[model samples]
Target: MLDVKAQSIANLRAQIKAIEEDSGAHGRSEARSSQCNGNASRAQRPHRRYGTAIDAQRNPASLPCGCSVLANSENDKQRFSQAKQTEEERDQANSAFAKIQRLLCIREHASALLYKRLLASGYEEHIASEAVQRAIDCGLVSDERYADVLVRSRLSQGKGLRGIAFELEQADIDPHNVPAYQEARFRDSGPDELARALSLLAAKPPKAKRVREAAYRKLVQKGYETDVAARAARIFAEQHDSVAIETR
Candidate 1:
């Protein structure tokens, strides 16, 4: 039995030696065949492609072609597909960013043009209304506080309700709020209003035979009623001379 075992071992060794010799010869033959076939051409080289055979072999599903430079397994295919999808998503995101950047480059000038056209054309009254709202939201303007300040300033400058209302209307302010602003901002014998009216009378005393006519026109332009202008003129005359007032 011992001799038999020794013989078997010797036979195995001889078989391995023969197999190694045959493998070496086969490798030489394969190299010769590759060279003769011009497989190493610059264009035919694996480097010419984007990914190596190893990468394809690792991700067979992503390869799209049945060529494997890498000894990768089926599991690698799923991973490669996921990675490719991620790359695509990133590229799309980059493209979107570029588009937004281009649009924003002209955003400021476009916004101004839109505002001018909207007001001038009077398409819907506040054509840039949406833009104004967005501006306010973005802190470019304030509607509430601005309304209060503007009304106050106009009233102080001797502008009557009619004049102020007209101006505010032109500015696309809501009419409903205009009345409220007028009521809140001015009252009977308002100091600001009285001062403004007094200034108008003082600027040029009605001198022409059209003196009264001129005063009336001025008062009307200032947004005062005929009655209010007459009353103010009478009161003003009593206090000073050469100052005439009338209303239309």
Candidate 2:
């Protein structure tokens, strides 16, 4: 009996040792499977990280906080610069207008002359042009009226029609209107050239020895037509000779 009991105890000890060995083998297999799964997940993690980095690079707006603020700041700066420029132009325009008013108060100016004056006074081109146009709209500048006055004044000063026309051109009068001004001065009950030539001779008779020739030359110089000057010189010579005979 003692031997049988000892043998049974030895068999039980062997069975326990075999079960422990099996458990250890199963545990090792499970650990290896978990390690493989972890390695695969780690490999996929790098790919996910790389894809996320690519997306961020492609779209800057996707950046968390600063990008949108910077864009808005740039837009604001541009708008402010534009506004400031507009304000400066407005002030310049106002200054130009005031200068125009003061000049008009002093004397009438042709639009072209006023524009040149404004530029000389340091106004911007566009601003000066606008101011001059405004003056025209207000009727503060009238080329027609100025031309009328200038024509009469020049004629009274012994300027010939051709010389007066040249002065008008220098004053920026339209060439097409020159004929109209001439007609108004000479044809509308105005002073005729022949009468003007006679009057000029009466005022300052020729003192040269060749009286007729000197008279004719003087009338021509005073802006009379050649035929008119010749007729006046002949008539004046005859009248002077008759007066001398009466004196003798």
Candidate 3:
């Protein structure tokens, strides 16, 4: 029985040893399997592509919108400023033009008054003469031509010498020239003036005394002396008397 017990113990020990060895082998296989699974997972893992990495790292906020809104805003502001400046310049130009027009009107009126005042004040004749000449040059009046025309028209209208002289003085005509003009106007009259005067007299209604009075007054009023008026009226009456005799 003792010999059988020892053999059983030895057999049991061997079985236990075999069981321990199997357990150790199984643990080592399990470790190798875990390592293989780790290796396989590492191999299967996706690689980081350069484009994807760049895209992930890129900031949308950093990207340019590529629109001209800012530039356009600046350009619009510049245009608006230029337009504002141009409008201001135009307004200033209009204001200047209005001022020039007003000044011109004042100058013209002042020039007209200057001659009258100069004559009345008994200013130096040359100064008054120059003022009139300047006014003529500036297109205000033409003294020489106007004087000639005025004298002729007045005498033709039968204005008296006194009335004509008075009017000439009022118009700022040269006092020196008025006498010459009055004399020359009558002196220059001739056979042509006689014919015209007779014709004008003939047109009058024959009231005899009234006609003579009107003819005398008209000639006298025309810057003619009393002698000239009487002579003209006599000459006109004689021609009419001759013509009446011829008609009978």
Candidate 4:
């Protein structure tokens, strides 16, 4: 199979070589024909002196008005084509560089999110990949750095470990990085799970047993552990019972 594939590639290269040779031969033939036609047309026209003094002094015959104009027009056309090609190349280079520059300008630090933004902003996949890789190399877009900050952010927002883990997953951070994530994970030295649960439970309006149970379920749904949720529910229920007794 490899031999057959190699042969096919060789055949394709031979075909391409033939096509290029044909195109060059055709281009040369056209160029000669156009030159002959231009010369013949210049010969048929009556000459009038209109060249610059230097042009006339140096070589008036070669820089006749018709021939000079045609030659300048062709040169201009070639120059314009070359300039357009150069502009396209420059634009691509600028876009690629600008994407990296934009990432560096982000003051909030970096993540896989920056890479996604570059891709979404219409950068080519390869360019985006290269930019992101460069960012990683420069430590300007470290997942570890992002994970540390994100864990702190989520914890400050009162999210639990499971919720934070899910958020990292959503951000496309690797599961293997979970150790780094945990190293920077939120820890409450002053409060155990039950204490945190109790505090969370204390912030609600008085409600019936079923609704309280539902709120406990909500906490669990918010990604707290089931054991913590149950403990908090117990504390909430006990406090409610105490309040009812005191009111009576």
| Weakest ten-residue segment in model 2 by summed lDDT | 65-74
Give the local distance difference test score of model 2.
Answer: 0.76
Q: Each prediction's TM-score against the native?
A: 0.40, 0.50, 0.36, 0.52
Task: Predict model 3's lDDT versus the native.
Answer: 0.58
lDDT, each prediction: 0.58, 0.76, 0.58, 0.67
The TM-score of predicted model 4 comes to: 0.52
Question: Which regions of candidate 3 are displaced past 4 Å?
Answer: 1-137, 155-163, 178-210, 245-248
RMSD of 4: 21.3
**By summed lDDT, which 10 consecutive residues of candidate 1 come out lowest?**
239-248
Kindly provide the TM-score of model 2 when superposed on the true structure, using C-alpha atoms. 0.50
lDDT of 2 by residue, 32-118 (tens): 999999999876565664765544445434556444443455444565578789999989988988888898788767788889899
Clashing pairs in 3: 158-221, 158-222, 159-221, 159-222, 159-223, 160-221, 160-222, 160-223, 161-223
Q: How many backbone clashes does candidate 2 have?
A: 0
Alpha carbon lDDT at 61, candidate 1: 62
Worst 10 residues of 3 by lDDT: 55-64
Best by lDDT: 2
Each candidate's number of clashing pairs is 5, 0, 9, 0
Q: Which digits, one per residue and each the tens of the lDDT, describe model 1 over residues 120-161?
A: 644333324554445545554544444566666766666666
